[model samples]
Target: MRILNTIESALSGFLFLLGIVISLYSVFMRYVLGASQSWATEVYTMLLVWAIFIGFSTALKEDKHIAIEFLYDKSGPTMKKVSQVIVFIIGIGFSLFIIWTGFNMVLTAYSQQIKTIDLGFPIWINYLIMPIAGILLFIRFCEKAYKYFVKHEEVTHGGDVEWKQ
Candidate 1:
């Protein structure tokens, strides 16, 4: 589990850095060189997508995702546990929905040979990030659920409140 978290974090960071580099190069080429590669926009868009989706997994692992903690804190431990369970279940459902929709979107793009406006690069390749990240997020949610219920541990929310998850 720890290994998975580390891998996700590293991958997210790498993708983010790659996106920044690509975007910087694109800007430099367009302004400094007075010209830009036709594929720069496509590449940057894909990189940004990958960074956001992969970063989601990292956020989940670190419990950095935003939540309204005021109410959860006021509740008792049992209520906190219940809230965590509900939240985890909802998160799993949402991830599954994203995976399903993303899969279909990618499939359609691949089937139609979708391409970028200027570069003609395969669009499905970019869309693939959605499902991959969805799966990662789903796994992370399941891991949290296991730790919450089976282990009966409380999740510390930095100093705000202890969530029984």
Candidate 2:
């Protein structure tokens, strides 16, 4: 799992960097050189999509995702455990939904021969990250559930955050 998380982080980081580079290059070409690249917008948008979806798993592993912290902080121990169970169930359900819908979307795109507007690449390639990330999310959520419930470890969720007046 550590290796998998490392790989996920690397892949998402690369995609994010590539997206930023592409967007900067596009801006430089348009403003500095007075010429526009037609494929740049679509390419960067696709890269951003891939980066965000893939990076979600990495964020989950690191516990960087946002939560309603105020209510959670006020909850008792029993309520906290109950909340964790509820969140775990919801996470599993959402992961399965993402897998199912994302897979179907890819199949549909492939069958319909959907292509990007500028680059003409198949749309399914852009969507391939969805199910992969979904699977990763599922695994991480299960790991967290086990650590929290079975091992009696506390699941951190923004407890240290200080609210501003």
Scored by CA lDDT, what does every candidate get?
0.83, 0.86
Candidate 1, residue 32: Cα displacement in angstroms equals: 1.9
Regions of model 2 farther than 4 Å from truth: 159-165
Using lDDT as the measure, the top candidate is 2
- 1-165 per-residue lDDT for model 1 (tens digits): 778877887887887788888889989998999897667777777877898899888787777888778987799978977888789989999999989999999999999998889878898988998899889989988987887777766765652334443
- Residue pairs whose backbone atoms clash in candidate 1: 148-165
Q: How close is candidate 2 to the true structure, as a TM-score?
A: 0.92
User: Which segments of model 1 are wrong by more than 4 Å?
Assistant: 159-165
Q: Which 10 residues in a row give candidate 2 its minimum summed lDDT?
A: 156-165
What's the residue-level lDDT of 6 in candidate 2?
81
- Per-residue CA lDDT of model 2 for 62-141, tens digit only, reads 87898887998899978987998999999988988998888998999999999998888999988888888789889988
All candidates: TM-score: 0.90, 0.92
